[model samples]
Target: MRIEDKITTAFVLASGPFTDGSLWDAVSGRLGAAGAEVHAVTFSADPESHAGEVLRLIDSAAAPQVVLVGHDYGLHPLLAAARQRTGRVARIVHLDTAPPQDGDAPLALLPDPATQALLRDRPQALVPAPAPGEWARFGSTAGLTPEDLERLSALSEPCPGAVLTRPLRLTGALAAVPSSGILCTASGASIAGVQQLVSSGMPQFQALAEPSVGFFELATGHWPMLSCPEELTAALLLAAAGGGRRLTPAVTRPFHERPFVLDAAEAPRVRTGLVDLHLPAAEGPRPAVLLVHGGPLPRGLTPTPRDWPLYLGYARLLAGRGLVGAVLDHRLHGLSDYPTASEDLAEAVGLLRADPRVDPDRIALWFFSGAGLLLSPYLAAPAPWLRCVAATYPVLAPLPGWAGVDPAFDPAAALPMAGALPVVLTRAGLESPEIAATVAGFLDAADGCGAAVELVDAPHCRHGFDCSEPTEEARGAVRQAMEAVCAHLSGRVPIRD
Candidate 1:
């Protein structure tokens, strides 16, 4: 193997959406001046490509060593090329690109149930753009200048509906090289959507046993090359030098330190980890409630303090109800597996019930938003010891226009099972307009099943509100709801004034 300084030649993979190599002109030039040869490969305009195109680019690369960099959806193909010719590849970097999802759908437009229900019935109310000023809210954090944003807005290639919906298959290549994730928090795309993009890569990363991967969360949105070239370059150089891992600082003291394990998983799997319990309380048979974090994609199974606003408070509330609540971080959200998240929830609940300290009949289930859709199917299948369910602002249906490849769940399908179990469905009306109709529809079809529904008028509330600091109105509603649930489950009605 020939060495070119301490660095190898750089090969850029510009694959995804309606983009091409043209986007990397500025960044590539910078690398070229840094004594590295830069080669850019394009599968085709937009995301669709001929497999031969990527192979040709690899064959044309300079011999000895090369660093393969892929951005956005382009990472998939670049990964493929590297597999065919191993030695030719020195390192692979996924810049703001997600690996692959369960479905093949463009990130820009994938359907969720709420989006679908509204669009299908009232397409007229659908605005082409919502709050154009939303971009400005982030100010410079978006990573693009007014001019760059304009250029992208003008030349941006639209992703085909097919590419966005179809899930990429990378089970084979991911088994090969360990890949690093260069998540562009500063540019490229907003975190709201990019979180999912970053998460999609996790499956392959875990499969490769490459959990040692590094991440650079630059404070930028999509299009880092054009918007924040210098920061992006610095990140690239650091990554090439293998200095991209986020580690806890040495100056930290025990009192000043809260353990943030970069790799906290126990022996079984490096990716799996447990968050240390923070709040100290008397060890007793508290209600064992599991906290499942909700996001567009999984972040892993470890629950941080940040998740408290969405789940911990609710767990505390359950504990206040004479239940020892043990919150288990669902896989993929905080640090668990994508498919295994639901399974872990079941396992965690089982652990709670079997703990001799906890009453097996008191075990319950809770799912919110995205997690709701994921777990609802499991609830339908039946699990012993799951006494009741509380799903708030549930994502019961798929988005209409953004249906990604195969829809794993349909809210309509799970609606029927609600009748057979003791369930309490509540939604903060301000969060989702579709909730009223969804709950009403479910209640109408109860068919003598033991379930109840409540729609609360809580402003600026969405899913996970009860788990966080709720407004006075939301708090009141939540208190009432919890009381009602306990009363129903215990088969005793509280005296009403």
Candidate 2:
């Protein structure tokens, strides 16, 4: 298909007072992440700023029904071109500017007398730095830290004067393409003004409210491209997605309030903690999965591929799929220290059960290897909120020299609880039948619980193999298990719609 026919490309036209197209660098990364093609253009002052080059670039760079994005002075001319190529323009996004007023002189028209006297003596303002710190002066710059600011400062360049001297006459363009304006607090006195102008009784164009073509104002200076790139990127993407809702950016903070402190009183003096939280979205409540990690916990282990970091990746995948998946370090390992870890798991389950964003009626427990033992007590007296349990290569039968560990560490004790809950068990090639037998014995004794067993042929498949080098079989196993859990929660057959 021709590029313009694709309808997925977005053209971000930039105005030149400053040739450095740094304004787009961060927002472009976000668009790329969200799977869109972006191109930046500069209409350097001269006749190029007036007309010809701008339309040509739009013709060459954009797809059919392009989302034409313009910043600063570029807004008016791009709108004019978009009007000319109405069929090719899907939406016109004006960042901190609006379409020109009727009777407003076009660039070809001499500088209007009203503005000429003022500009004749307009003192030259210093070229302001577009650094991160400079952007923080605006309220919209929240969530931006010094480092992000530093990155932007490095890419910024000086602005030119000629581009600023020109004013756009967009009356002709407004009659063609639909336009939406993203205005900043600094430049335009109010979004209401633009709305009023676009509303009724205006000399320019008819103010019929085009819901799709409107304005959104952020509490920031004239430059949102610099002050709040993340927010801007999010808003722009929403605009691109036909005005989708925005998600709050992830925050970095302590999982608990006590604050981290190390007490060298015990042999393994590392402090550990467990936390369960839900990320609420407007999409409605989603399934919540609880993660329990495997044996011989690594010292000070955070999420990395070497250990079962694959589960963390899986949780992210689940979250992306409109489900709420949580990962927690069990007691005696990870960030949670000793007795607290076990308490945390139970508390987390209880908490999720009470949460409105989580389907309190349908929580699934995902246990792998040694971590399977942590849920023994709960299995023994399974919570009303617990819907199903999946144990992959769980060490169900206590081996020799297993009694010295934590009481909650006894899967053998928890085995009886399996009778009341649905169970899924998986064994890989490297895992022996002895592992399966241990789990089977427990399930066999349970009155209502029969394990769904899946065994692989290879005798050497290591633990966490699915996570480390995922194959179709492994993915199938996880997907099947998830579907089973969802089915148990929903009280229906496990089938993907």
Candidate 3:
């Protein structure tokens, strides 16, 4: 990759995790030769103080206008500074790192969430920088050589565990700031890969498809400055000029807003802040199917999941089938909040069984997406009242990134304990790699333990097919899964047609 035009915008390089400014010496020289002024930052303090360091550098620059180029942990300080002075930044380039939200600490985004929590709780704990050879545990080291590793080891420092413990406050100041992403392919991620995640409506990557953002990819590992300095320089130059591949925002609506594929059957619904009940006009008690919506959704998300079309449609559809439908709300906003979510779910179920209108002897719990984690307890020790478990595109095991989440939340590991509890899972053919792996793992575990699992395949569909897919395959799969769940609720196994 080569840039025809020289770049005049000053580049403020923010180093990630273990490295410092000197790590960018080769890259800085290359940028300087191309007529750009460069300042590689050594983050001597916390994220906020590093922001001040960046601000001071910006203040001392001749043009007083700079492009903030940040890699991994370096992004926190760069983002902090950018939020402070959005007008002065030419562009913010995220170099192969997860872009942190307003309150996201490094621990939340990094691989080991459990270990990070342990370290955070200890008094004056610090995150020890890994020895050069051990860096692969943190990120891909596909392109670095022995010499490169030695150099990287020399240009690094131990991180203070306290950094970003306090949230980086955002005032929506960075919304208008144009941004770019530099993806490292050898790091197990690519520009195309990111687009796929954005298309899934994961919320976090939604901003990447906005008109103000662009993306570039390098066929190297995480540390592009060390592995491919010339190529990195070229991409940075183009990015500074607002030139890179721009993603067209996905046209599919999110699960909350999209109309459910099933036709809405009019049924009377009662709302209780915690659970929404859809009832059939029946005289006696009826079997109930609890519809659990999936999410790590923010508390502020309007028209909560229970009020969403998917949940409402499912509840009404069940009621029309001469059964009671219960839609529940659980608190599951962050990575570490699984315990809170579980407790909320348990309370909702207790309230559900105690209701006069619901037959306590016959009940089924249906889980979806991220709520898939909550399925563990019910499967691990199926209660006599629990009839069946139904899940759609569910995450059975923690994704690779969630290495430190509680192992007890794993449904795959709990399969052996799911004695005779009929299970139905709807799998998506086009699901993302991260999600597909978990679903596959769960099925494999169930097979190994001889657990009863009925699989329904939705071929050529994305993750949230029920909401986004307007095709026959998706609708058919949903119907099949529902039939299996209802059959089990009525004390019988569904016979395949």
Give the range of the ten consecutive residues with the poorest summed lDDT in model 2: 262-271
**Candidate whose lDDT is highest:** 3
Give one digit per residue, the lDDT tens place, for model 2 in 1-497: 42223236565646433334555777777666665667666555363444556577667764444677776456656766676777777778877544444322222111123222233355232234345665433223444457656765665554333344444434444555656667666542355544422332211223325445555666665556666767777666656655632222213221121111211111111112354343423255666777775553433434421123355454544454445666666544321132445676777777666666777766788777656666577667776667777777666654321212333455555656555666666655555444556655655655334433333232344345454334555566656655665566564222222
Residue 339's lDDT in candidate 2: 41
Scanning candidate 1 in windows of ten residues, the lowest lDDT window is 261-270
| CA lDDT of every candidate | 0.50, 0.52, 0.80
lDDT at position 412, candidate 3: 89
TM-score of each: 0.49, 0.38, 0.88
Please, what are the lDDT tens digits per residue for candidate 1 over residues 231-257?
777677666666565422222221112
- Candidate 1 lDDT (Cα, whole model)? 0.50
The residue-by-residue lDDT of candidate 3 on 455-486, one tens digit each, is 99988987888888879998998889888877
RMSD of each: 12.8, 24.6, 3.5
